[model samples]
Target chain A: MTDDLPPLLLGRLNHVGIACPSIDDTIAMYARLFGATVSTPPFDLPAQGVRVAFIDVANSQLELIEPLGPDSPIHGFLKKNPAGGQHHVCFEVADIIAARDAMRARGATVLGSGEPRIGAHGVPIIFVHPRDTGGVLIELMATPDHY
Target chain B: MTDDLPPLLLGRLNHVGIACPSIDDTIAMYARLFGATVSTPPFDLPAQGVRVAFIDVANSQLELIEPLGPDSPIHGFLKKNPAGGQHHVCFEVADIIAARDAMRARGATVLGSGEPRIGAHGVPIIFVHPRDTGGVLIELMATPDHY
Candidate 1:
């Protein structure tokens, strides 16, 4: 927004995160309905406290994540929604640190520890507070295979 | 899910729909944060009872829709959510009817008259009941232009 700083190197929408109650059921539903391809099989990411899978779409992908343990954000979301729905939208950025700093300068809050963490896809990412982004949690992922 | 039917012609993820209270504010937020470009200008689609705009992304787009009239679906969404959030994920399909029929045969409910309606993007689109799609409102958009 400001002329002083350069634009953030934003790439494509990498994937849309869908909070799923059962990755198995979700995979079955999409596969049966749309013949969706599963690029990533279901596996537990203990660090993120979620079991995750990726549904390959033509352009981007859909990430299905279920809470693995208590106190996980996905668990909190499912408890609030119960029906499971879109959780967050992850967009690729060329430089993670630059995007983070630029967003902060523009008054956006980076969630968690404000440091890049290994995301569900094994790429470094940071979550921008939903409060700052029209009440939608947005994850900025570093592309071209992270630093 | 049935193998008798040929696979539905699913295309790329076309756009993700985001309900907005004010298109102006939404555009401003994305621009200031990520230098996001506006692909489609704000325009009122009275037929759909909504005001719509498209934000450009590398691979796809974000459709920002606000309630134009009181009974608009976006109006109901805003009322239910209040803070606004991701409303639906739209995927491009080569053939709309075949896709709809495939879903119906598989026990998925197609919203409205079970016919493709002109969507916010002026393309033929239909909504599959969230109940059938893992609680996420899914929009199947006809691509390569429509009939």
Candidate 2:
């Protein structure tokens, strides 16, 4: 049966990124609340100028991201408003290529073009800028299972 | 087969509430992108002094909320910041009654107790003030299905 549904653009939520003042504190809180354990400790994303850590949930994850240096984008965001809060929502897409094209046709801007890049859990991913998508930074990924 | 996984503390995502200067503009943009029409137009929430509308997705929604009066919370939020962006994420719980009790025991404050009210889809819901949830307003609901 060809489901004829608009093709479930997002497979499942890969992760949710939350901006944190300190990963130490956030990790501790998540551990207590959801029994999440630190899977990926703070690592720098030089390209994005931010550091991130992942607290593994059963299938999804909680990513805690902090700015690496003063010039980082996350730092600039923190400068304006320093309250530790949600940064973005990441979804696992069935096909990054098709999903990116579909979103672009719908007037959404794909941050990077070409082959999908690896993210948490070695999943191939792409990012959709907030400017084109109602002010929410959305990440699309293809999980390892699909790959 | 019984999957012993602890059921999601919250059901599927309820909505992503955005505090925009104009709900009409936000609603138009979302409609264009998601290919989903607004389930309802602006309705004033006098208790909060704001107007809200929702764009339904597969199992969740995107909410566009704007301040109705100048003294409203959203009005102040927009004035205080330039990049008035994604405001909050809401999740549906299994039982608002039990969830509220558990959250309170965990040191979280429940905003509107005893008002087990219906939301955009007539599902019972409640809100936990951001003040209690690390400065982010969180909504909890008891929807029928788990997303």
Candidate 3:
């Protein structure tokens, strides 16, 4: 059955998501230590219930996210890990809907409504459940139009 | 003092380590689902107390690791997470010692003996603690001679 499936086009890793209590502090640390180029001022994503900033590296990015409010999705994660930690990893895909269907056909679980929502990069993204991803929350995002 | 420092040269990400109870199972999943090209057979790294396999991607690799024995460092990780999960992320550096010194100067904690140990890839590698890295266990390795 698996032999009949088409190739899964998991594109390059776009960014790694890090859950931090304070994006400013993390941005400062990255800048001071690694001389990293961090994106200015975290912007709110009410839909995702978090504020996010991007720290650009040579090949990829580190996304720092903080809970937006009490009802934020990452609030529980922050409470459990007050010091912050690696949240999820995002991978780019040329076609998100195709990726979603392929993953689902292979028994991978897609989180939320099983639909791609606009992510911070202004591209459609879907989260694959951790259980199916060997304990990593995997976010599959369509490559931004600009990219 | 920080203003006078040169920019840290963080190379492309090398791989993301996933700790799994069974490398065979994970390899099968990646191959069957993602049509990933996994390295043939898992190799034991007795020094690290783990067996490792690689799944090649376009930009980076996915390292699937399993405990070598009872004393394996990842034994406890698997015990806590029976189903397995993301363990660490590795990045390449031109000079690991210089990277270590810079990180230490900026108050980041290096794990183990604070020295580079020969990693599975046969290169000098050091682990930066998650506490200082926004909760990600970051491995910095000197780029291989061939790379």
Could you say which candidate leads in lDDT? 1
TM per candidate comes to: 0.94, 0.71, 0.92
Better of 1 and 2 by DockQ: 1
Model 1 lDDT tens row, B12-88: 88988898888889888888788886878899998788899998789888899888987787877887777789999
Native contacts present in candidate 3, fraction: 0.53
* Runs of candidate 2 exceeding 4 Å displacement: A1-14, A31-49, A53-61, A69-72, A92-94, A98-109, A112-116, A143-147, B1-11, B34-36, B39-48, B69-72, B81-84, B112-118, B121-124, B144-147
Q: What would the per-residue lDDT of candidate 2 be over residues B59-102, giving only the tens digit for each residue?
A: 45667788877677677677754345677767766678887776
lDDT of 3: 0.83
What is candidate 3's lDDT per residue for B6-66, written digit by digit as tens? 5865787888888998898888777766677675468999989899998766677788999
**What is the C-alpha lDDT profile of model 1 across A13-67, one tens digit per residue?**
9999999898889988887888875788898888888899998888899999988
**Residue B28 C-alpha lDDT in model 1:** 82
**Model 3, residue B17: what's the lDDT?**
88
On TM-score, the candidate that comes out on top is 1
Mark the 10 consecutive residues where model 3 chain B has the least summed lDDT: B1-10
Reference contacts reproduced by model 2: 0.15
The runs of at least 3 residues in candidate 1 whose Cα sits more than 4 Å from the true structure, single-residue gaps closed, are: A1-8, B1-9, B145-147
All candidates: CA RMSD (Å): 2.5, 5.8, 2.2
Could you give the DockQ of candidate 1?
0.60
lDDT of 2 by residue, A95-142 (tens): 778887878887788885645677655667778887776566788777
